[model samples]
Target: MKTQTAFPANNLMGVSQPDLKGNGQGGIFNKAVKLFTVAEKENGSLIDQLSGMRASLDKLQMNVFIADKDLNLIYMNEIAYSTLKAIEPEIQKAFGLRVDDLLGGSIHRFHKDPQAVEVILRNPSSLPHQAELEFGNVVLRSSINGIFDTQGQPLGYVVNG
Candidate 1:
């Protein structure tokens, strides 16, 4: 049996193009469109803020790394990149990952128990935490903190080592 919907499917295109003036579906559709428009504007603003932050972070003397909410590595300051590069060989032997693949990669690769780590990362209260990580013969101390937006939404995390 065929099903009915507030926005009927266009048989030829197989897409629902709800009427903006007719059914109650128009109200819901209009609200969703407005919501998306606002979100786009907010995202653009966030991008601008991050670009400025990146410039400042690049000038720091210490190693600094950033990861998105999904735990994907997003940014590494100059010092962080160079320091990691110097130990790339050891890292390869220890984790079987290349330093060049660090950016845009999952932070899980560095953890022995990623799910456990993820639990902490996702919980803002658990952050501003400190830990020592061992890679090969090197022991690095890291300070992890959550990054949040103006509205207190989690953007990701920052790690200083």
Candidate 2:
């Protein structure tokens, strides 16, 4: 004879109740939907904030390049673009890409040891880092700083050279 249990087998197995079908009502599904909605809204807000910040950075006279957490080049201000453009020949020789191609490219492409650079960029404590980068005959002194969100979570890096 089987003994009666106080709770349902599904509950013991950690399965969601049938009532919580994530149908935008009270349930695990609903909670997951709400979580995703909040996350999307936060991401939208971040994008908007970044857009405004990018506008401000665009007007700066300094050569600035912004990369995402994964080190993908996202923005290169006019000064940065022009500065890189001036050395397009060298850049092409080294990376086989034009300045226009730099956006959406990986910052690692410019480094001799990308894995080492990635280690530093991913560590907040290691920044703001300063280094001199050589491209053929040209040597550029660059300052790398991590960008953080309101919660102090790293957003990316800004390279000012």
Best candidate, TM-score: 1
What does candidate 2's lDDT look like per residue over 1-161, in tens digits?
32222222212212222233644222432343234334434675323445655665665445666777678888776657766776788779877988887788788788889989878877778977877766566666667777665455666676665
Poorest 10 consecutive residues by lDDT, candidate 1? 5-14
Q: Quote each prediction's TM-score.
A: 0.68, 0.67
- lDDT against the true structure, per candidate, is 0.63, 0.60
Give me the displacement of residue 146 in model 2, in angstroms. Answer: 0.5
Q: What are the clashing pairs of model 2?
A: 22-29
Query: Model 2 lDDT vs. the true structure?
Result: 0.60
- In terms of lDDT, the best-performing candidate is 1
Model 2: how far residue 84 lies from native, Å: 0.9
Candidate 1: residue pairs that collide: none
